[model samples]
Target: MNFALGRYFPADFPLHRLDPRAKLLGSLLIMVGVLGARDLPALGLLALGLVATAALGRLPLSLVLGGLRPFFWLFLLTFLLNAYFTPGSPGPLGTSLEGTSQGAVLTTRLALMVLTASLLTLTTSPIDLTDGIERLLKPLRKVKVPAHEVAMMMVIALRFLPLLAEEAERIKKAQMARGVDFEGGILKRLKNMVPILVPLFMSAFRKADLLSLAMEARCYRGGEGRTSFSELRFGLGDGLALATSGLLALVGTIW
Candidate 1:
């Protein structure tokens, strides 16, 4: 199933092996900075960072664009809404003296955030990200946030999304064979999706229950006293990445 959301960088670049904590922190900082960015230059730099990271991971443009496919319509909607309704205070926000500057800010922020986050996922493995998350939520352990459990769940979900999507696709195909008209008008298509969605939901619930039982059977209690086999250690490269990200974020915020 293509839905697996595979941890699939080319595995040749130095970035691929860098500490996941570095990647996660960098991504968060970049996202915050990009979302807060109002200036075009800052956004451009953020875009460049995203592109550079993608390149560092040796990811193909096609792969990146494919991820962007689901957002094409979203982008169109954002642009139209911004261009149409935004107050033309700072000289018409649309193409020419049309939309509000606020709308433009929102649209640009959304785009930059999307680009940055996509790059993060592209470069970092799901497992590494989960581990990073558990580490990050260490503070929450004091408050009983079940951070490790949440991280495990997310890792599992990411691992399975593609598989489920594939399963949905297969179900759709089988229904189509049975004269189910799923490829019709939008409303019709959505309703037809029920056949796929119901079973998917059931499967997910069952999987969750089974996973919990299995973990309990294995004597897995919370993260308490849990030692990881793959102990994460931040190295010089991680420091460098974090420093670079911090500098960029500070610049964006200050500017």
Candidate 2:
């Protein structure tokens, strides 16, 4: 129910204090660099960077690992599918290898991607992150894609995440009080979730309704020339961060 899907990193770290523009840009460079990586060693390097950055953010190792929980099966499935299905060389070179290498490559790639993404959320606060993102995408306005509006929508979504989490937590406590143990086995837990999910969803809809009304009352229009309270600026620290990430990208590309 912790809807804060973003900001995996706790605040107070030096990285956490950097401008959102720097963080967003650095995160993009890392993601693009890692995802573009074709070789295993380069991918491994990307993973290492993610770990180091996460440590820099001062997040708990357990929290980092926990994010990988749901993806365990995904990793496994990716590996299995790739290993068995990635058309391979026949004869002695092929060695009839099925899921081993392909699976490993796929899983490794996915893990690195996830780690990189998680690092972004861990370090950046929700509001500033979205604001930076919107500002970054502002250039896309020429195409009439409504970049600002989209950004506002994303901001709203991120803002509600923690609130929704609290609501979910409340629902969970209420269910638990009724002897609905959500800690049971899979099916049992799923069955128990019905009570919590139903009410939580209803509450979310209600909240959404109220939010719509609130926005309407405030005369909120689309993000047309909407100025931000905290303007994003790139400082020396931001430059250093960007340079570091770019250097990493360079290394990744050549390696």
Query: Using TM-score as the measure, which candidate wins?
Result: 1
Candidate 2 C-alpha lDDT tens digits along 1-255: 423244345579888888888887887888778767767888788778877887887888877766676467788778666665667654233433544665676688788777666666777777777788887887887887787678778767756665777788888898878888888677898788799888988999999999899989988886765677777778999999888988887787678
Instruction: Give the distance in Å from residue 87's predicted Cα in candidate 1 to where it truly belongs.
Output: 3.8
Candidate 1 ranges beyond 4 A from true positions: 1-12, 89-105, 182-184, 213-219
lDDT of each: 0.73, 0.75
The sequence of per-residue lDDT tens digits that candidate 1 reaches over residues 1-255 is 322133345475788888888988998999888877777777777777777777877877777656665456677778677767655544532343445445556667777776666666667777777789898887897887998889877777665655566667777788889888867787998898888889888877887788789988999886678787789999999999888988888778777
Off by over 4 Å in 2: 1-4, 7-10, 87-98, 156-207, 213-219
* Residue 9 lDDT (model 1): 53
Lowest lDDT sum, 10 consecutive residues, model 2, at 90-99
